[model samples]
Each structure stands twice: as C-alpha cells, then as structure tokens.
Target: MTERSYNSLLSTGRIAGLELSNRVFLPAMDMNLCVEGEISDGEIAHYTARAAGGTAMVITGTGAVAWPVGATSRHQPAFSDDRFIPGIRRLADSVHAAGGRLCMQLCHHGKTASVDTADGRPQLVPSLLEGGADMSALRDNPMDELMRLATATHGKKATYKVADEDDLAWVVDQFAAAARRVKAAGVDAIEIHAAHGYLLSSFLSRTYNKRDDRWGGSIENRARLTCEVVRAVKATVGREYPVIVRVNGHEYGAADGLTAAETAEAAAMIQAAGADAIHVSANAHNPFADFTDGPLPNTVAAYREHTKTIKRAVTIPVVAVGRMLPEVADEMIAAGECDFVSMGRQLLADPDLVNKIRAGERRSVRPCINCYVCVEQNFFDGNPKCAVNPALCNEKVAVLTPIARAQHVVVIGGGPGGMEAARVAATRGAKVTLIEKGGRLGGTMWFSQLTTPANAMLVDWLTHEIERLDVDVLTNTVADVELVASLRPDVVIVATGARRGRPAIPGAEMPHVLTGDGLRAVITGDADADLGSIGGLGRVAVGVGRAIGLLNDADRIRRLSKVWMPVGRRVVVIGGGLVGLELAEYLAERGRLVTVLEEGKHLGLPMAMPRRWTAVRKAAEHGVTLVREATPVSISKVAVRYRVGGDEFEVRGDSVVIASEVCADTSFADQLAARGLNVKVVGDAANVGYIEGAMHSAHEVAREL
Candidate 1:
C-alpha cells in the first residue's frame, strides 16, 4: 500500500493558455476505427476508456484534413468537411465527460496515401517519389503476409502529383479549414500532423522536397509549408487555442532527411509561426523495415536524444512521444528534457496505466513487452489490437462480471495463461487455485527475461496480481487428476504450456548438444534430470549457480549469464524463428559467435512485422549468421552440418542448441476431461500461441466460465 512518487509526471501543465490535469498525454496513434472519414462509436469507446483511466490529454489518431483526397485509408477520420463534425463532437464530449481533454491531430496523407491510390487519384506531395527508401527488409517478409496487403489494397498502386503553388495553397487552406471544424466541435486543442512521412513532413525531407520553389530546398524553405500550415491552423483556431505541431525530431534510413540540426531549426520556425507547443516524433523513411526505428520505435526513450535538442531550441513545451514509460517520462520531465510525455503503446497495453500510477501501484501498471503486436495491424490498414491487453479495441473485455453461481476454479499452470485465467476468474468471485510444476511461478516467461528483459515486467506484475487477489498458489508441485479431484473444482483451466523435445538428427544425442528444455534446465539448475544433454562444463556451471543461489533470481541469472554463461564461444542455434533468432542475437551480444539455421526461407514467421524486421536487422548487425533454407543434416561435437539447396555445409560450433521442435500439449487437459471434470484448456497447451495467444485464450475461456 506504499505510494510511488512521480511528481513532475503527475503535475498539472499548461499548453498555450490551456491547463491539463497531468503531464501525461496520449499521442496520436491511428486505431483506424472510423467510417469513411467519420469517427465510429467503437473509436469513441476506446478513447473514453483511456480518458476515464486518468490520462490528462487524449489525442485522436490522425484525422484527414481533406477527407478521401488526403487519407491513407477509408477508416481515417476526416475533419475537412462539416459532416464529420458530429462524430468529432461526440468524441470530444465523451472524453471531456471522462475528465480528460481531447485534441485532434489534423493530417493529410501525402505521397503515401493509399486511399488516393485505390481511387486512381494522384497523392499530393511536395515533389515526386524519388530514392532513399531502403526496403531490403521486405525480402524477409513472408509472401503470404505481403500478398494479403496487396489484396487489401484492391490491386491499386500509388501514383503521385508533385505540388505546385496552387496545390500547396490548397493544402494549407485545408489544414486551416480542418482546425476550424475541430475547434467548433469543442475539442480542447489542435495538433497539426507534420511528422512521420505524412504530407507536411514530406516538405521537410530534403530528399523528397527537390522542388526549386519556395516550398523546398533550404531548411527554412523545406519547413515553409509546415510552418505555413501551423500559422494557418493557429490563425483559424484563434491565438489561444493551444495549437501543437508534431514535427519529426529525426528521420532514419534515408539520405538528406531531417537531421537533428535541421529538425531544431524547423522547430524554431514553427514556433515563430505561432505554434503553441512542439510535439516531437521521429520518422523512418522506409516503412517496411525502418518503421521500428521511428514512429513506432522498439527502443525505450526512442526519441529522447532528439527531443532534448528540440526542447533546448524551442521556448515552447515539448511532448516526447516514443514508448514513454511513466518512470522514464517522470525522470525526463524532472531533468527538463521535455514538458510532457505521450504513452502511446503503454496506453494500449493498459488503459488504466495512469490510474495505477495515481494509486501508487506502479508495479501493477502492466508493461508493454515492447512487442510490435499492436502496431503490426497498421501495415494492412487495420485497427490496433494489443497483444498483452485483449481489452484494447474492445474495452468491455476487462470488465469481469460475476459468475452465475459460486464455483471453485483450479488453474493447472502458473504461466501467463494460467495466471490470467486465475486472476480473471478469481476477480469474478470464483475461489481460485494456481498450481505449477516448477519451483517458481513464471514458466518460460521467467526464463525469457534473459533475452527479452521486458517480459520480466509482465511476470512480476502478474505475480503481484496473483498475490493481491489472494489466489491459492502451490509451486513445486505436479498437477494430476487426483489433485483436481481433491480440490473438487467446479471448473478447471489448464494452461500447461507447449510441448517441446529434442529433434531427431545425426549425432543429436551428443553431450555438447542441448535441446530447448535442456538449455533452460542448465540455466535454472534444473539440469539434474537433463544432465546427459549438456556437456561436463555446463553441468559444473549449473551446480555452481545453484550452490550460490544465483538460479533463484531470474534477473541475476540474466546479468551474470552475459559475463559467464555455460555456453561456448561458438554456438549454433537450430531454428531461425522467434525464439531461435532472439536467442542468437542475445548470445552474439554477449560475445558468442552465433549462427542460426532455418529450414524455411524467412525468419520469425509469426512475430509482428516491425519486431521481425528489427530482430533480423539487429541479428545481422551483431554478426549473427542467419542461413535460410538450411536444414540441419547432422550435428557433431565440433560443428553442425546443414544443407541449403543441393549443397551441404557445416557451421563450426562448440555447442549446439535446438530451439525448434515444439508442438501443442493437451495431454493433461485430456486426462482431466476423461475424469468427467469441467475443463477448459488455454495457452500453448491448447495451441502454440506464445504469450499473446496465451493471454487472449485464457481471457476468452475465463470470461465464459
């Protein structure tokens, strides 16, 4: 019940003359929940949840300044016409009633306007599409995923129209008109979308704005159009309307892009043009691969370095927008780095993030595992759906109604899925018991902290919730029909995770080789049973780790593993999918030479597109060799031989780890079912869904129960 302090983050703040309740702002992230440029009721509900959750300011996703002419999708709301005002008004009123201010981000999708492409109209741009977009990452994309996007596009391709003076005039006029509509609709403020690779931002990119006219060339000229739009928006909305300009703090993966210096200069110009505040964001030129580098970066404080520069350059308040965690945002504000922070993905991960922070239950604020699952839908012009929070798009899912009658619930695993089922069911008045086979609560999730550290936050939060709910938890115990029968549970939720085993291959049983569970066992000192799989050195490492009690702390194990892991200098991983690729990169970072062999053409098939691209890019940067279409033929103590096409080659390795050969495990569920027990299976046990699938599946079944 102790309170956590984040004074600066929770303090009241002002933009222009408008006072907000707190410094936390929800920056514009497209949910694509609009109907032909009009806000849908679903979109309003999504915003209202966040607003009621206690976010001081909630900004709508980009709304087209000129409707279909300047939209990227039919679902993008429009502010150009009066007909869209009613939807805007409803949204504003709802957010206001929920005790939060609302801001509309006015946008005009320029060269990237797919809606224009679909309608056979040229997308307006500062200049024609030229070069500098690095799309090499697209090669790694699965053909089926790419083809689906093509199919969604209705077979139309983008055509561009370089803007002339009149076209520029029209663009500026549209923005002004849009702001007028927003202000009249009772929105608290206006945010002009001049960031990302959108219309106004295209003018700022030196590579794209090749025009010799006033709208292009020098920094001032390149910024002229954006500044003009800011001035027009300010003029239209009146001087004290709290206008914010979202400008790219930096652009990645493109030549002649908005450098840090250029961005600072542009911020000054926008300020001079009467923008009340600056909303700093970064952009990646290549949408395919570089998307994670900006707009939706995977890194923490993704825009902080650039945001600091712009904050120093401008007298106005600066809002930092990339993955702004509460603690980081609070520290940044205290350090005078920025005035406000936008918790975009964090908001999606947990709508009540602000409420949790206000209640001093910061640890209870579910952390976004930095998985790109939410933004992945944007590639297909689809609405945002959070992997961690199933209630994101549908706010009602988190509201657990009481069960019809009092019932005892037995959750047969302590993994995320099992834990979630117990939490939800217990919250709904069910007496719950969580049973785990391992000594600890988190299963693969606890071990996953070694590579993806963010996952540890979720494990910690769920463990805290499990404890807070007073759910009976039994660890270091095996589940069986007898156990459930003893509990006499009315409902049994089985989340026993995935089934994994050693792959059958030449020399597969070599002492130097480790299977997935074998590696985990060695790390956790559970290798007493799997000692045959690891070499003598690994066995010694495990004993020493457990003797010193290092195996009990996942974080300690992760940190010490970097310096002294039992693995060899040269390691080969047997799968190029999510687990294998991430493990390879993690090992490479710790100074181990790593190689990953995949029988398939692509790596990380089911991982979200942005994360998949980033993993592939970073693995290469870390000197990890990824061999596609390579099927392992044999494994020796010294090397792993694999075949790519007709030729076979060997990758030298001191240790080989098999990160593949996993399947769904429903044995326990089947056993319980045979005993006439009311059973529902979830997580990897039912199907190989990993964490996201586990959460969703558990929530679905638990809700029904």
Candidate 2:
C-alpha cells in the first residue's frame, strides 16, 4: 500500500518544551463526565481512546481553577486544590500509557459561571454589568437547563459581585496554584482558558471590560489580567513547561470585541508574557459560533484566516481550530497558515481519524456533520455524543462483543439502522445479508442528503463500510417471511424506516400538494409509477425535476438544489419540524418565497437546540416566513388555510408541501416474530428519531447479536 500524503499535518512538531508525535491537537471540550468536580472513570476512558487513536496531544476539557465561585458546570473537573491531584494523575498516566501527551486546561468561569452553581455566592465579573447572568455569555444558550432556571429568577436580576483589586490577585494566585498542582500530577502542559468570554476573556473583551484600573482600559490594560495569569502560571510550572493560551481570533458576538487585527496584537503580547503556544479559537457568546452548520460550502475552514493572521504576528506556534477537515488542515499547514490544527467535534466523531489517514483509508473516516449534538447534549447534562458515531461518549456501553455462536443474520432495510446492524453483526463474525426494497441502501437519508450535504457524506461513509465488510447487499429486493425462511437466518433485523404521514385536510389529496418524501422521489426519479397523485401541476414539477437529469446521486441533487429547486415561485411548507424547516431554507434560497406553518410551539422538534436555532435563523435570513401554533385546516390550489387561536388565516402560495411526522413500520418485525424466528427492530422501524436515533438504536440491537 502506498503511504497517505498528510506531510504538513503528520510531521513531528514541538510546542514549548514538549515534542509531539503529530501536528494535530485535540482541543479542550467539556465531556460532562466528571462527578461532583472529580474526574470519573468514564472521563478517563474517553481521553484514553483518543490518545490510543494516535492523536499527538490531548488538552483535557476546561477544569475549574476556582470551585463554586467560577464553576462552569456542576460536573466540571476541578484543580483548585491538592485533592484533585490523584484523579488528575490517573488521567495523565492513562494518556501517557496510550502514547499521547496530555495537558490540563485551567479555567475560571468568572461572569459566565452558572448562577445555580454559584448558589448564594456572588458571581464574579471584571466590572459589575447590570444584567449579571442575564448578560452572561452563556445566557444565549437555549438548551442549558441551569441557564433557564437562572433566567427564571426574575424580579431581582441575577447577582454579580465585580472583582476588586484583591479578587484579581486572588484569582491570579488560584491559577498559579492550579498550574503547580497540574505540574505535580505530571501533566505535559497547562492551558489557561482565556477565550469564550469566560472570566479572563471578559477582562480581555473590549465590549465587557470597562475597568479603568491597571487591569482594564486600553488593549494593553484589558489584556493585563490574562498576561498576569500566564506569567503567574509560568512562574509556578517553570519557564520550560509548555503553557498554551486559547485566545479568540474574532469575538463575533461582541460589537466592540477584538477583531483579527486586535487579536493579533493581543497574541503578540501573550507570547511576550512567556507563553509557549497560542491556541486560536473564536466566538464569544454565540452558541453556533464554534460549530458551523453543515450543508453550506462556505463553513469549511471557517477559522483558518484567523490563524493565518495571528501566525504572522507571533513567534510561538499557533494552533488553529474551527470546523476544519483533515485535508483542509493539511493544506493550511502546508501553506504555512499555522503550526498545528485543533479538532474538537471531528475527534469526537472518529478518534481514529488520524490513524485512518495514516493508513491511506481517509475515505473511511467518519465525518463530523457539524450538527452540534455534542454541545447541545453537553449543556443538557448529558455526555457528549456524535450524530454519526453512536459510540462517541458511551464507548464502554456500545462496545461490539463477539458472540459465542456466529449465526446468519438477515437485515431488512438499507437505511442507517440496517447498514449499522449489518456492519456490526458482520464484524462480530456473523453471516449478514441486507435487503432494501428501494433501489438504494439509504432510505429517506437520500432525501436528507439533499437538505444537508453532510448527511450525504454520512451515506457515503455508511455504504462504503457495508461494502467493505463484504455483507450481501440486495437492492430492489423486498424481505418477507418466505425469503427469510429460505435463508434460514438465525436473526432478522427490520429497520424498514419511517414514512411521512398525510394530514386530514380538505385539499390534502390535491395534485398541487406534495408530501416531503414525494418531492424527494420526484427529484431522484424514485416516484411511484402512478403520476396522478402529483396532480396536473405536479406533473409539471416532475417534468421540470426530470429535466434537471439527476438520478439517485446525492451530490448531483445537492448541486441542482443550490441552483434549481423543484418548488414554484411561491412555496408554503406545512409542519415546521426538522425536515420542514430545512426544506423551507432550501426553497427560499433558490428564490422561492417560502412560509413554514408549524403546529408545535417551536420549529425543528427532535433536533438539538443549536441546530434548530441555526436552521430557524437561516430560514429567517432567507425571508422564509414562520408561523408557529398554526394548524392547517385546508389547502387550495393558490393558498393554504391555517388556524391559529380560532382565527383562520390564508397564506398565498403556488405550491404546498406536507412535511409532517414520520411513523415507524413494525409490521415486518412483527410478522417475523409470529413465524417463530428471532426478530429485532431498530431505527425508524422502531422509533422515528432521524440519524442519531437510528444509528444509536442499530448499535444497541446489533451489539446483542
């Protein structure tokens, strides 16, 4: 086999006093695996997997340097005292044993600290902003339960006690002691969390810091606290120990915050303060700032320019991190943009990405869809998880163990759930055959690919793995009781996916109205043989769709959707769930005036908050009208009549699309069970949760087999 070319990123590198195996760094991301401020075994396993996967270095997620007063989460690891040293030591040793160097990120949440965690204690800020928790960087998060509770404490504003001169000194000392404790625990480096509008970042922020003391005012004065913390850390850990400073390349949320130019100047000052390396990250309070949404092309390498700008201003190695792809990171390094690349969600999606790239199997590496499930789930008190990779944080629970007796498995359906079931069973030494009634393996996922480009990438990955495993894949083949009995399979998995339900409305059967799946089938030439259901205008839509000349190919559909959407000049999408909201964005972007009618109080149900917020925001930006709590009563050829609070309103549109709930089909599994054969149901066939649910359910059922 020929060696894979990733020379720029795979080259050995040095940061401060430590020599790294590669230029890739796993940037700090909170896993919420700690128990009562102590590192749990789950957290250790989480880090160890990444280390063993061959990442050059790992930065442990943000740990509190000042507990209670500056805690970001109740479960966040702490290094404020000597008591945390033992747990820190075990974590360090595990990473070291796995052939990876580990660094501890020391942080003080400051003004952004959770009010619930602060309890009756005063939340510390650089200056006492009037809003306190209401004005906190974390206040924008819609998924944070703690933030919701804190926001609910109305009447009186969330209290804040501005850090005085004594408090600043005390914080500096706390950081210095944390650095000393980490050094004692054999940590390779200590990264001061000075980004993300945290305590130190609030002081650095021109938008937040209004202090006129030595620690605030000018750029030099505002950055003084961060510089002092860096100096204090170096003094305790010694000049030779590597200390990384994570600074924002651009604070998008702050109106007067540091731009690239200001950030470069700040970076130069940080290096001058004896810091070893600069880890460049961006976004202050915006939840969507860190993880860019997938589907669009512009979000690729979103933060490389920031790193390139800062690299020229400082002598220390700059680590650039954004929604960077492996090839993009390599090219950025080759172009001398930055010395290292840091991956957060990418690593979570597949820790073995580096290993796969090294083995010339880069195509097999799972991609991070940038769905923001990790950040969304974490803030909701759940451990981080990847939509594509089900075994992300729940590594121990999702492990695939070999069965005592290898049996023949027949999986009905070629969707994500079925594909995953086949892959797992085959890997566990079972003879597997996957049958799909559709011509393709991806069920509704092909339609999903049209909405989000990353979902198309996921289909590519899933199909490739199924093929690589040598599983028998039979497309256009329906599985019934007779077929399974002929094969005499010991186990049968039915993942026959979900179907979009039709609502009972006056014009529901009108030819002008189309189901979301019907629209997809028309686009891909997978429509039913009967053209009558589409109506007279529907035939025109199909003809125009066929003229685009796309088959089952997702890439072509995606390219076509960008320029040519099948909808009319005016479109109204009913049911503003994930599919409806996404389709509205898709239609509106193609010059169609779109309106989304949802019965639910919110758009994008079942989707995580970050993704929902992003999709809804993008739809609004594209001029897509959203009407919540609107029940569709009937549809006319030229308009849609929906009711809200006993008031009927008509939305004029040329075309109406039904993007409603999907119902699971368990008839296949039920029939198989009746025949006295072992049967399992997964994915939409069992429950309709889209990708995350499908993959997770598949993994769970397949593991048992």
> Model 1 Cα displacement at 422 (Å)?
1.3
Q: Candidate 1, which ten residues in sequence have the lowest lDDT sum? A: 526-535
Residue 338 shift from truth in candidate 2, angstroms:
0.9
Task: State, as a TM-score between 0 and 1, how close model 1 is to the true structure.
Answer: 0.97
Candidate 2 clashing pairs, residues 3+ apart or interchain: none
Error of 1 at 678 (Å): 1.1
- TM agreement with the true structure for every prediction: 0.97, 0.94
The lDDT for every candidate, in the order shown, is 0.87, 0.80
After best superposition, candidate 1 residue 142: deviation in angstroms? 2.0
Candidate 1, pairs of clashing residues: none
Residues forming the 10-long window of minimal summed lDDT in candidate 2: 289-298
